[model samples]
Target: MPPQVVEAMQRPMVPHRGPEFSEFYIALIERLKRLHRTEAEVLLWPGSGSAGWEIAAVNLLEPGDVVVAGVTGDFGDRFALVASTFGADVRRVELEWGNAIVPERLDAALRAAPGAKAVLLTHNETSTAVTNPLAELTAVAQEHGALVLVDAVSSAGGIPIEFDAWDVDYLFSGSQKAWMCPPGVAIVVAGRRAWERTRETGTHRFFWDMDRNLEMTKKGWTPTTPPISLLYALDAATAMIEEEGLEAVFDRHRRLGDMTRAGLGQLGLRLLADDAYASNTVTAFFPPDGVEARTIIDRMASEFGITLAGGQAHLASSLIRIGHMGWVDDEDIESCLTALNDVLESV
Candidate 1:
């Protein structure tokens, strides 16, 4: 259950090519910088995180450039596949689907792929509800002097990701997840090293071009017209995060995650992710013996008005996923848990 954020729905739209929009755009970028904990440039594009994946590819990598990718879940696999389609050599460090990427394995891959120009990782693997050891993996990347590009779609605002401290050269997130806003914007934040790499990148990307955004961004605008109302809503929503303080925002997620996991324990459910690798945004649970995940999810929704997220890929019907991202809290969690308990009892 998402918290009541009625203000976002009521925000007035403005002209995307006008002065009013420019002021909002510039301020929103600075505000996003605080959210990202970086001094790097933040680019806003007219696509989902899917587009951010390719933007990262075209902006910093030309054909034949090599990168080491971490494959822990579905999105991680897709990111590597996207980079490969762009003509980059994709070397992967594969891990069990429900587990986080062990830094040692990545270190080995880096050692093996010395020509690797970048390392791609998902900060939170939504498909598995596991938070990768980004701080550890990026540290290894820095040791090898390789740029780090991160997909933080599911974990952006809910989980802590310090772009500067982690030395992640490229980071991108979508608005729909933790932002609790409508989808249409792909936010990409790039560090100085990643920005410089763009100069040597010869790939052609017109609309998803980060360089054009970088230029327009300096003047309080964008390369193309943006979703002005969604920008207005993002301004309203993410600003609320700042008012609550980032630390408290993260704690809210942790508290809810802890409580949700505890509730799952009382229900005799199994968390798909290992405890140490579990995420604060979402929790994936393997269905108990003889329980149908799809049936339970259907019952929880159709019967109880509780809408929980579902798993991806092979785990789709094998696990029940509860999204505790964005503005979820104790009461909302209690409601979901109660619905879950009711549905489980009948199971």
Candidate 2:
């Protein structure tokens, strides 16, 4: 958690149903809307980022509906799995792990799948560190008369995403990632069209129902026991972001990303993704020859007290990931890189 966000969570708890909480809730919603770059209602949920997938799936998709899913990495694959679990006929437009999901493939898939209800895209695939071209994909989805849904868990505040400008119908993110808050809360933004589609769907939903969540939001409260402390942390984190200005925050991430990637290149590491689609929040790279990713990760944490992430699943032993988002500074990146260089030499 960010320092200010941790401090905010330490404040004495307030009754979640009262006017005091109502003001806090409303203010948080406004901040979330600003972060989302949308005028749509932003729904808050006391759940992990994975819940965002379930909520979006249950709300907008009914059994037997066709959906065009763009899968570039693990999270993208998860979205497709969620859609399939909901009984949607998912046409998966897959790409190599390090590659971005281009609009042409999605347009082709959506065109072939007549009456497709939605096109699911992962804005930033954290696993592979590839950021998809959201604007172009959203335009293609619209051209094919499909609702655009995005999982922006790792990129929302770390990079600039114009939700309204892209006409995105449904998008969700986690508070723990770019929001610079702790886990346990997720934000979901639904455009009017998405809400209408939810109403038309016959999917049985209780806790994740958008209609109920919207009504409670209008009343400035939640239907169930909310995670008040996490909300406070989110409020504080968002305040800091707003104070610094969103554009400035994005530019900071962009600079940090470039610096980190250049430093990695200087160390003779192989990046997972191409320069055009590399993510600003996280970078995945192959270890130097004869050095395993686990060897570097373990040595970094055990010796230097710096932790690095290994690739997921089959790529686990093949590559390493370094995160440079959410309150990270140049000094932090430099220290990590220095430690990484030491680890490489030791290996």
Candidate 3:
């Protein structure tokens, strides 16, 4: 977490219903809207990015609605499953684990399922460390007259995501990832068309209701008691980003990503993602010969006090993930690389 974010959290707490809290909430949301580059309503929830996925499903989809889901990695597959679990008839467009979602393939899938309510895609597949070509894919989906829903949890704060300019109908992200905050908040944006659709065919909804969230937020409130301290942290993080300027922040992430990949290459490790599609927030790499991914991750933490993440599901034992998002600097990257070098030599 950023130092300012931690400091903000350490401040005194205020009641959720009080005027101070309400003012704070509104200010935070406004900053978030600017960050998202959307004039539409942005909803905040006391939940995780997974909760944002559920909100997208429950609010925008009805039973038996056709949904075109592009599954390129774990988070993508999980979003597809969320739609199916919500009773949507999901037409899955599969991609290889480390590959990106091909726009032409998505276009063809949308053509086949002309009546798809929405084309669901993950902007950054953290599990595979690949960032999909979102603007192009959204254009294809729109050309087919289908709404575009994006899972941008891992990309929003680190990369540029213009919700309105890109014509995304629904988009969701977490406060944790690149927002430089701890978990417990989800940010969701619904475009005008999506809001209209919600009014026309709103699914069974209660707590996660976007309509309710919008109304409450307008009045400077939330449907339920939100995680106040987390909100404070997020507010501070957003300010810090604004202070640095979004362009600079984005540039810094890109530079760190390049540094990490090059460092890993020099160490004779292999990146799982292609250079063109590599995620700015994280990089997934295959461990060296005769070494387990978890072994290096553990060794890095124990030996150098540097933490690293391992791949999920099928890639768990095969790859390691280095997260360069949120509060990460060149020194942090160098420390992680140095630790990996030591571990690789020993193991």
Candidate 4:
């Protein structure tokens, strides 16, 4: 951990209702608003990114109520499953595993489900390494009067998400991704439309409660005990992002993607996604001829001290994904590429 972050966590514990804790909580929320670029309410939940998933479902979805979503990859499919657990009639407009949800299909699905309450989509499908055009697809959702909930866990901060400009109803992200911090803190940013819908929601939730989160935050604190250490870490991460400037951070990730793509292209490796739809944080590549991806990733980690990630499901044997979101630079990219080349030669 960084020195400043260690110091923040080492500070004396304050009562949940104490003046110090209250002040810090309020200040932290304000900082998040600036970082998220939203005038909407930002709720910090004390669990992983999936906790925000449940919160969104409970707060907006109801049993038997029809919900429509674009299933571009595993994240979107899992998000629909969670919402369906709330008893919502989840309808999916699925694309092939390697492709994104086309805007035309998204619009058609909304029109098909006339009374749909919300439409779920992953802003960036980490499984397939692709970024969706939220701006265009949200326009289709807004036209149908359905609230848009985006899974931006791997996309937010690593890329640009225009919350206010796009009129996104609800957006969720976590600190583990581009925020460059440890996990355990998930954020939910909701616009007034989604908050208003909460009055009619009957999904029944407590710890991951959003309505009470809004109410208790009146005093600048959570309704229950919070994760004090992770909270401190999140604040420090936000400060680090601010110091780097958001555009510069985005550019760094973009350059990483560009360089990785170039390197993989030079290596004659097959990319899983098209250039236009590729994710800035993760890039998936099919191993070169006569080479197994798992072997390359394993050897890179064990022999060269270079840890890399393999693809999911069908692409596991063939593809390896390079995650270069936070705490990564050109040198790290070079190291991964060099080690991958060496591993392929050895294999």
Candidate 1 weakest ten by summed lDDT: 1-10
174 Cα displacement, candidate 4 (Å): 1.5
lDDT of 3 by residue, 153-263 (tens): 999989888888998999999889999899899999899888888887657789998888999999999999889999999999999999998888899999999999999
Best lDDT among the predictions, by candidate number: 2
Off by over 4 Å in 3: none
Q: How many steric clashes does model 2 contain? A: 0
Question: For candidate 2, lDDT tens digit of each residue in 223-248?
Answer: 78889999999999999999999999
Q: List the candidate 4 regions with Cα displacement exceeding 4 Å.
A: 1-12
Better of 1 and 2 by lDDT: 2
Question: How much lDDT does candidate 3 score?
Answer: 0.90
**C-alpha local distance difference test of each model:** 0.88, 0.91, 0.90, 0.85
RMSD of each predicted structure:
1.4, 0.8, 1.1, 1.6
TM-score of each: 0.97, 0.99, 0.98, 0.96
Regions of model 1 farther than 4 Å from truth: 1-6
Between which residue pairs do clashes occur in model 4? none
Instruction: Mark the regions of model 2 whose C-alpha exceeds 4 Å error after superposition.
Output: none
Q: Candidate 4 residues 166-283, lDDT tens each? A: 9999999887888777788888899989988998887668887788898988678897788887888788878877788988989999999999989989888889887778888989
> Which candidate model has the greater lDDT, 1 or 4?
1
Pick by TM-score: 2 or 3, better one: 2
Candidate 4, residue 311: the lDDT equals 75
